[model samples]
Target: MVIIEAKGLTKDYGNLRAVDHVDFQIKKGECFGFLGPNGAGKTTIMRMFYSLVVPTGGYIKIFGMDLNRHASYIKSRLGILPQDNNLDLELTTLKNLIVYARYFGISSSKSKRKAEELLEYVGLTEKAHVNIRNLSGGMQRALLLARALINDPEILILDEPTTGLDPHSRLNVWNKLNELKEKNTTLILTTHYMEEAERLCDRVAIMDRGKIVAIDTPENLMGIYGGNLEDVYLKLTGKKLKEENNVENNKS
Candidate 1:
């Protein structure tokens, strides 16, 4: 049932090593999360999972199949939502999903049906014909989510899935994610939101500077570290003050 296995996974951009020899395993149907400060290689690892980046060392296997040999098969079963919005501005909300579904070789008729179903599921039926640029931030986020699920993927890979949404919108997305997990879909998510990670992830791996510094269930990790997930994370990574600086810089 080990759905994801990373053995000394490493990625480097010239002399700048983004992901070091990191190792982790994720079980089938488990909500596994990756947490880290900005530029901590969380994105690099995420990109590697979806074959966006070639690694400098080590290897990964998904569903017991070596990623190098079976990337197409592995990707066929994946649903990905990147941290940044990448919707087609020229396409209507429904069309976005329809086009993405076509990449999976879904029949045109089935793709249209799937698009309509997902649009309604995300509560965007009214705006299904709206241009992507005209939708509100929250609405667009929901649409992006709907697009990810259009293919009915077995493994959902979400990077900052609920970022930039209001509390209401965030909760809605959270509920949808919970429903997906209930149906036994394996999820891998990366987020700066500790609360989201604690709420959704059965286990989380805290990465710092291209390496996994800690990995455990939220409760067990908190128990072992004698604090909340954020506190435990700060203690292990020793980046509380640095993170604060980064936040301040972003605001300014």
Candidate 2:
């Protein structure tokens, strides 16, 4: 089933058009990725999905309902993992999850039980009592994942979910994401990591200069354009997909 549908989706900031008439559909239980170099409108598209930004043109339908008309209802079913680790540093690992649950109107008793389950799901049960400031970067990212799941959202949106993690830590998060996929969660993620896209996404939309240049499976894109996802990116965007080194300088 198509869980998300976008037609002529566009976003503008003053004179600059960040997302220009992009179109795509994401199916239920599918891992859909947005892969591109910085300033390619990848992040802008993500923000629109979660309603952080309003579109200047066209429409988005989530679960067959128009986004503009049903934003609150649509947002309630989404779990967003933003690029930054915006965790409540003042709270303990478990408390962080519990407090976020309050935003969804979950009861204290139910939130506590859900928090414990998510902590264990992300392998942070050992650090449940630890302060957020003391946890490693990877652990904090994992905690962010747990926090995002507090509402048991059907669509989980991640923006650069593992941008700065070490290799082992990246894999740990990947393993958790893989398990989530196994259970049929619809995932929408934006990443510069070709390997991450190849490993997680069932299909990817490759964007360039505010438009999607290609949309297909990694294997199909590679077969048509290059030997790997990086090559395909270079061929389509005329830029190499590095570690998003200038991410801050090139925010779309």
Instruction: Provide the clash count, candidate 1.
Output: 0
lDDT of 2 by residue, 186-234 (tens): 9999988899999999999998889998999999999999689999988
- Model 1, range 93-157, lDDT digits (tens) per residue? 98999999988899999999999999999999999899999999888888988988987889999
Ten consecutive residues with minimal summed lDDT in candidate 2?
A: 243-252
Candidate lDDT values, in order: 0.88, 0.91
| Candidate 2's TM-score | 0.95
- Model 2 ranges off by over 4 Å: 243-252
Each prediction's TM-score versus the true structure:
0.96, 0.95
Best by lDDT: 2
